[model samples]
Every structure is written in C-alpha cells, then in structure tokens.
Target: MNREPLSTKEKLLDVAEELFASRGVEATLVGDIVQGAGQRNPSALRYHFGSRDGVLQAILEKHLTRIEERRAKLLASWPAPGPRTPRDAIELAVVPLAELLSTEAGRRYLRILGQTMYELAPDQMKGVGKYPSLSATIDLMRGCIDTLPPRVVDERIQGTLLLISAMLAIRARDMSSRRRPPLPLSTFQRNLIAMATSTLTAPHDEP
Candidate 1:
C-alpha cells in the first residue's frame, strides 16, 4: 500500500526534527528547516509555527502526548497500591520512553528531547500540571525511594531523567546511523532500566 504524502506542515516538522536532533537546537537556523522541508516560501515555518520555539514545542507535544498516554495506561494497569519496588517504578518510567525507539520518527524525537532536557529548569522537567502522567510517575518513583531526604530524592529523580534521555538519544543515533548497537535491543533496554533503578535506589551518604 502506498503511504500518504506528508502535508506541508508535517514536512516542516519532519525536517525540523532531523535538523534539531543532528545539530543543536540553537545552531539550527529557521531557514535551514524551511529549505530542508522543500518549502519555497521563507514564511512557511512562521505560518505553521509562530517561531523557532513554537516549532520546538509542537515537536515535543507531538511525541510526548503519545508517551504520556502509554505511561497512563501502564500506571492504571498496576496491581493495586502501585509499584512495589524501585525497579518496578523505574520500569514504569523507562519503558514508555524506550518504546519510542521502535520507530524512526520516535527515535528522532528522542534525540531532540535529549538535546532540550538539560536546558529545562527543574520544575519544567517535572512538567507539573501539563503532564499529569509524568508527574504521577515521578511521584511513584519518589515513594519507592522515600528513605532519602527530599533534596536527595529530587536530585536522583533529575539524574534518572537525564540518564534516560542521554542513553536513549545515543541509542537512537546508533539506530539512525545503522551502527551496531553494542547490545541487542532487549538487552539494552533491560540494562538501561537496571542502571536507572540503581541510580534511584542507591544509598545516600552523609555530606
């Protein structure tokens, strides 16, 4: 069956995602995206998305909405009181995000997310009211690690997010480039979840 052609707006988004992922977002120019999308009009990006930031937001919303839905389902399917261990909560957090690796567009979004995540403030990373599923996952993970002081828990949570994004971004890049991923996909995912679980559950040392 023939695939449907992408609309002009989708074309722009596709090009923008690639450019933003390969080049740092700040380094990718608006004109580059416009030209890459084969849009003759210089204003096409502006017409579809108000500005560079708007384009970035659209890209994030497009991918994250799907991720949020998947996470919500996982959370709902849990047996009663929720995740029983640090690893269980970590699996909830990592699995939905890792599923993105199954598709090319999803992989590109992962790369883009990795680029942008470090720049976000702590509150922004939590996504707070905007992403209830993500917030709930964070809360669930926090409960599993409640032995730590509040500040330490927050730091580990942030670290876990950063680690997920960075590692998945590298995996995405490998898949995109056709490089041999050191481990098979199943092994990679299991190990990634294990590493993240360790980060969250590691014992805290006194300052």
Candidate 2:
C-alpha cells in the first residue's frame, strides 16, 4: 500500500503534537521534534516554525480553526439571546472537541491543548491571543454566564474555563488510553455538560 508522505511542516507538527502531549511542551525540545520527525537538520524547526512557541501556536491554530468552525455553526443555529440552558452554552464550547476525539489525531491534539491550558508560562500565554475564533467562543461563554448576576459572572468565569479545560484534558487522556471501566464518549460529554452547567449557574455570595 502506498501512503503519501507528509510535508516537512506537517511532519514537524505531527511529531511535536505527540511529544508535547506525552511529555510536557517545555520538556520537549526542538531537537527532539526534528529527530522524531525523521529529519536530521536541527534548523528544520526554526526554518518551518521560527521557534518552539511558533510550532505550538501553529498546531493550536490548526485544530482551533476546525473547532471554531463547529462552534460557529452551532452558535448560528442557537437562537440569539443565546443558551437558555447551561448545557447549551457548554456544549457550544466543547462538543466539537468531543466530536474530534473520535479520531486519533484529535485525541493527541486534545492532550497538547490541555497542557497548554494548564501549564504554559505567562509569556507563552500571549500566543493564545492570535486565535480570534477561540476568543469569540470564550466571549460567548461569558455572555451565557450573564444569566447569573454580574458579581457571580465576574467571580466564576475564569475558574469555569479552567475547570472545563482540566476536565476535558482528563477525558481526552482517558479516551486515548482506552481504560477499563470504560467511559463512552457520549457519557463523558453528557457528564461534562452537567458539570459545566452547574458550575456556571451555581450560586455565589458577594465578598
């Protein structure tokens, strides 16, 4: 069977995604990525992606573009003054990624995304600003949370995003491993929607 070869840029992205997911991004080196991609040139990473951060951002953009498209379509169908249910808003944000998890690459990418969400340094965080789609979805979630009082929305929004990232990462890892007491993807999505809904809508006391 003949398989078309990956381009130099894609080879790097593929190798980097796996390494970044299995080993933390900071722990993985440009040398490691190029070597894993079957390239001998240390300069290949720099030539293709400029630097480690550039590679990571490119990988993120690749996936976010697709995920954001899904979110946009979902948002379009959802009525304006949107997301009457907590589940509605949360699903708009995450269900696309869950659908992506049906593929091997999606699982790998999710692991890297989880690491980025939880582990990146403050300076590294700036790269996230490059993705408008991601920002739009986040703003949508904030608007969804507006059903709550302004005080609660202010207090809980950041934590809600963090929790969503962490939980989805955990689920992505679990999905990749094919663990015993197996969690079906549908079940995982259902539970996540429930948890996210509760977290966003949960009552808060003013300080």
Candidate 3:
C-alpha cells in the first residue's frame, strides 16, 4: 500500500507544533522547524510563512478560531442575557478547549499556549485576538465578577483564567501520553468551575 507524503506546509505545521510545545516559540528557531520538518532549505519556512511570527500566528489561529467558533455557537444557544451561573461562565471558557484535547495537535497546542502565556508579555500574545472567546466568556460573567471588590476584580479574574489554562495544559499532557487521568474529565471540569466561581465570588477583606 502507498501513502501520500505530507505537503511542505503540512509537514512544517506538524513539526512546528511539537517543537513549539516543547521548546517555546523564541527558543525554537526557524531553522529548527525546517530541519525538524525534514527540509534542508531554510527558505522553505519563509516560502510557507512570511516569518517566525507569522508561523506562530498561524498555529494560534488554527486552534483559537475553532475554539471561538465553538464558543460562539454555544453562546448563541444559551439563554438570553448570557450565562446565569458561575458554572455556565466557566463552561463557556473550558468546554471548547476541553474538546480539543481529543486530538494530538490540539494537546500540543494547549502546551504551546500554556508556555506562551508565561513566555510572552501581554502585547506579544495579542495576535491570538487576546483570546476572544475567553474575553467574551468573562464579559458574560460580569455579574459574578461585580461581586468582587473593584480593585481586585481584574487581578482575580486574570489569575483564575491563568489557573484554568495551566490545569488544562497538564490534563492535555496526561491524556496525550495515555497516562491515568487524576480525575474524570467531567469531575475535573466541575472542580475547576467550583474553584473559579469561588475565586470570583469570594469577598475581599480591606487591605
């Protein structure tokens, strides 16, 4: 039986995803991607993607757009005036992403995203539309968010979002490797929703 070989673009994307997940964008050189994808010519990367940043953006867009589209569909079907409970808000953020874990590339994307959150400054991450789905999801939770002190609301929400990403990255890694999951996905998601809800709704003491 014969199998079709990968196109130059496809091979680059496949190798770049794994390399970016393991070594981060800045650390993983353009040449590294080319070499990993089995291309001897360095210009192949440039031919396919204009630059390193373009490649990174392509990778992010591939995953995030899917997530946002899924969120948009979910949001449209949800009750009017947006999510009513903290769990509803949390589900908006988590479920679309959780759906990605079933695929190897999706798992790699999660790891790369977790690393990007730490490796890049805020401006550097803006290429991913500043996470449109998550921003929309959080906006829908403004009711719960309003319960926190105004000063702490921004920080608390940002921190909780980071925690969710980190947790899901770990879960993605575990599932990709076929390791025993610490908890069922549903249980983990419920626990995460509980934690995010508590964090958002927790009262702040005077500083």
Candidate 4:
C-alpha cells in the first residue's frame, strides 16, 4: 500500500521546514503541511512521519547535517588558542553555530528549535540526539562544558545553551526589527562567541 515513501517523506519534510520556518510551527498544522506538499492522501502525514514530531525530527536532521559539517571544519582548524582550554574549544564550536542565527534559514530553524526547547516545553534534546550530527555538536559542547568550574559549570552550560537558543529565537521574532541596523552575521556570531566564552571562562570575582 505504501508508495515511494522516500520521495513522500522528503517532500513532506521540505514543505514542513519551509512552512515551519516561515510560519511559526505552532501556527502550522499537519493538515497544512500535507496541503503545502500537494499530497492528496488523507493519511499522508501519519503514513510518512507517524506524527508531526517525526516530521520535525527529519527537518532538524537536514539542517543539522550542514551545520555539523561546518563545525567539523572549524574544529579541525583549531588555531593557537587550542581546545586544551575549554574556552577556546567552546568558542571554536560556538562561532559557527551563532553565525548561522544571523542567516535567514538559520533564524527560521532557530525559531522552531527555540520553541521546542522552551515554548512548547519539549525535551527536543532527545530527538536531536537521535541523529549523530546533532549529537556530535552537543558532545563537543559538552567536552568544553566539562572543563568549567564545577560549582557553576552546570548552571553556565544550561545558561549558554539557553542563551544560544534565545538569541536565535529572538532573531526570528524580529526579522523586520528596524530600530537599529542588525549586526552582520559574522560580527554578531563573533561577539556572541566571545561573550559566551568569557561568561564561562573568565575568572569570577571571589569576594
């Protein structure tokens, strides 16, 4: 009964990602995704994804794959400020991720990711981990996180993750924010990397 599942799955994910990216995922429904993909099968969504969450997972895998490739390249080039220091490794890892937030696609993906991470209150970390690409990034970040101050590392790690998610979400929330010129993608990411690196690595004042 199933027909061309791969093509259907890909089409569904493509339409859904675009729809979710352009329109908040909450605003778009599974019926809407099926419609956008021009599929007539009433059970198209269920047959393909089994659930909306499944579709989301596929979309995330597509995006994360490209991002992981970039991260690997960057990590491979670890310059003088080598990863021996967690700060250096974290920055090396974060710069590429942050830079994407400044992009149109990145912003859209972030909005959806942010919602999963916070708004919808889903522990997408699990879904994300299902794919090795996303897990690799998290693993790298965790490696850096492991090197931080024990008393505060947990808090800082959680905060940094949240900050990145929030920043990406905020970018989408204000796609047309015109009060001030938006920071260029590279610059914003550079600053974000530094800020996050400093927040975790800087010696805190011990009163």
Candidate 5:
C-alpha cells in the first residue's frame, strides 16, 4: 500500500533543505519551498517556521549540528596539537571536513554550507552560532588560530575555506563521463584530504 504523505511540517522541511542546499538561502524563497512541498496553504511558512529567517535558522542550525558532531569526534581522535606548525591546525580543520563531505547527503549539504559562508549575513551567522556543537568548533578554531601570526593565519584560512568549498560544490562527473551523479563519496573525500594536506603544509612565503 502507498504510505500516507508526509505531514505538512515534514514536507516543508524536506523541500526547504533541498531548495536551500541547491539555491543558497537568499536565492531560495519561501514560496518556492512551499510550492515544491505541495502544501497549498498560503501561510504555511509563517504558520510553521514563523518567518523566512526563522526557517533559515532552523534548517542551518540543524545542518551545522550534525557536521560539528562529526568534527568533534575527528578532533578527539587526532594526536594533540604541538607548539606551532600551522599545518597541524589546518589538519585539525580539514580531516573532519573530508569525512563529512564523503556522504551523498553530505555532498549536497557541504556545498550548501559553502554557499552559506559565501553569502553569509551577520544575523544568519549569529543564528548559526546558537547551535551548540557548531559554536564549539568555531570557538576552538579561534582559540588555536592565535598560535600563528594574525596576517599569515588569516590568509591561509581564507584560501583553505575557498578550496574546500570548491571541492564540495563541483561534482566529479562535471569533468568525467564515466562518473555518476552525486559523485562517489569516498573518492571525493580522499582527494579532498590530499589537496588540503598539501596546501596547508606548504611553506609560508614571507615567514
């Protein structure tokens, strides 16, 4: 027998996640999610999530929680940080990211995260901060970030984030016909880890 359709609320969130992931938050409107969800109620967004930003906060906070949990586990398993090789710090950030991006759902969410960071609104970022696990990772990164000189670390972090974002968004199949949709998760993860290690460990030009 055919199963009952998802509750209106569940359907809204399901559609919202895909729309937000594929289109970026600002570009994906409430109308679109509601329509895609097949819920004819005109006030569905307001009734369920309260407002546009509220919906964004709910979805992003949920997304970030899962990611940060994995990140914490990865950090916990790694060897403790030494005095000052910034590469150590970079690996701290990279490994878990590679692991997270290795899943099919993770691939989509990873790209959405990049788009979120790129198009970040201060309010939205603050909302993201309210999620416990994610807030902890950001706090930890900031604490360790002080070990390297400010200018150098700043440049490296920015560059690394961009490279990571690109890896998350651009599917492997875009370059090869033999590749399949959503990309193969493990291959993507290994390649990302390799690229991140090489970039982070490279010497600083001026120090």
Candidate 6:
C-alpha cells in the first residue's frame, strides 16, 4: 500500500519537532525549520504557522491529541472507583506518554515535551482543561495523596510531572542513539512508575 507524501506544513512540523527536540526549543530558529524542511521560500514557516510559537503549539497538539485519546481509554478501563492508589494514578499519567517511546518522532516529541514542561512555571502548568484525561488523572493522583499538606501535595504533583518527563526524555534519547538503556524497556517503565508513585506518596515530614 502507498502512503500520501506529507504536505508542506507537515514537512515543516516534522523538521521542527526533530530540531526542537535536539536543539532545545529556545535555540531552534524559524529559518532553520524552514530550510530543514527543504523549502526554498524562507517565509514558508511563517505562512504556515504564523510564528515559532504557532509551530510549537501545533507540534504539541499533534502529539497530545493522540496521548489524550490513549489516556481517555485507560481512564475508562479502570475498575470501579478509578485510580485508587498512587501507582494506579501514576500508570495513567505515565503509560500514555511512555508509549510514545516506540518511534523516532514520538521519542523526539517526548524530549521536546520535557523541555517545554521544564521551562514553564508551576502556575502556567495548571491549564489542562483541553486535556480532560490528563486533568482527571492529575486530580485523582492528588486525591490519592490528599493526606499531605495542600502545598506539599501541589509540589508533589508538580514534581511527579517533572520526574516523569525528565526520565522519559532521557530514555528517549538513549533509545534514539542506539545506546544500551540502563534497564530493559519493561524494567525502565516499571521502575519509572514506581519512582513517580514514591514521589507522590512518600511520607513527608512536617516542617
């Protein structure tokens, strides 16, 4: 079977994702994306995406929409009283993102996502209304650890995101480079979830 060639905009997006992941989003220039996409017209990226931020948002939406669908299905499949434990919530949070590790583009997306999340302030990270599955998962994970002080719980939730993103980004880089991952894929995932669960559920000392 034959597949359609990517449209000009898609070519720009594909190059942008790779460049953004490898070069860091702040460092990847619009002209670089345009040229990398094999476009002769320097204005192509601006024409298609309006600006660098537009392309960045488009890249995020492209991957996140798929992740949202996967997470929604996982949320639906949980037995009654969904996500009763930290591990359950962690799995919901991590697995959909982790599944993206299987391909080069997906791996690049993970790295880019990690960089993006790291750069955002905590307050800026709360606008997940567009990603209901992710929003629900965060709410449930916080509920599971509600015994903690409110501030601590918020920190833990933010920490969980940071940890998952960083670890997945490293794993993606390792896998992409054809280097031996510190652990096999299954072990890496299980340990990553367990570590994230601990980040959320570990007993906190009152200060």
Top candidate when judged by TM-score against the true structure = 6
Tens digit of per-residue lDDT, candidate 4, span 1-207 = 878555877788878877887677778899999988889986798997888888897777677788777866776676664346555555655666666656667766776777665543223443555445456555555566575555455455556666666766676557634334378656766676776666655554555
Give the winner by lDDT: 6
Instruction: Spell out the clash pairs found in candidate 4.
Output: none
What is the C-alpha lDDT profile of model 3 across 1-207, one tens digit per residue? 888999999899888999888676779999999999999898999999998877887998888878888998998897667338777887787788877888888889888777665544333322444667656677656657776665566666666667778888899888877899989988988887787777666768876
RMSD of 4: 5.5
lDDT assessment of candidate 3: 0.78
Lowest-lDDT window of 10 residues in candidate 3? 119-128
The alpha-carbon lDDT assigned to residue 169 of candidate 5 equals 62
lDDT of 2 by residue, 1-207 (tens): 998989999999999998888787899999999999999889999999999999998988888888878877876676666336556667776788778778878888887877776554433333445555566665566677676775556556555656777777777777677765256667877887788778877876556
Tell me the TM-score of each prediction against the true structure: 0.92, 0.83, 0.83, 0.71, 0.67, 0.94
Clashes of each: 0, 0, 0, 0, 0, 0
- What RMSD, rounded to one decimal, does every model reach? 1.7, 3.3, 3.1, 5.5, 4.7, 1.5
List model 6 lDDT by residue over 1-207, tens digit each: 899999999999999999999988999999999999999999999999999999999999999999999999998887787338778899999999999999998999999988887766666556888899989888888899888888888888888999999999999988888989989999999999999998989889987
Steric clash pairs (candidate 2) = none
Model 4 CA lDDT for position 15 = 82
lDDT of each: 0.88, 0.76, 0.78, 0.67, 0.62, 0.91
Return whichever of 1 and 3 wins on lDDT.
1
- Candidate 1, 83-168: lDDT as tens digits: 38888878888899899999998999999988987876656655566888888878878888888888788888888888988999
lDDT of 3 at 4: 93
- CA-RMSD of model 3: 3.1
Off by over 4 Å in 4: 1-6, 79-83, 99-104, 119-152, 172-181, 201-207
Comparing 1 and 2 by TM-score, which wins? 1
By descending TM-score, how would the candidates be arranged? 6, 1, 2, 3, 4, 5
Worst 10 residues of 5 by lDDT: 172-181
- For TM-score, candidate 3 versus 6, the one ahead is 6
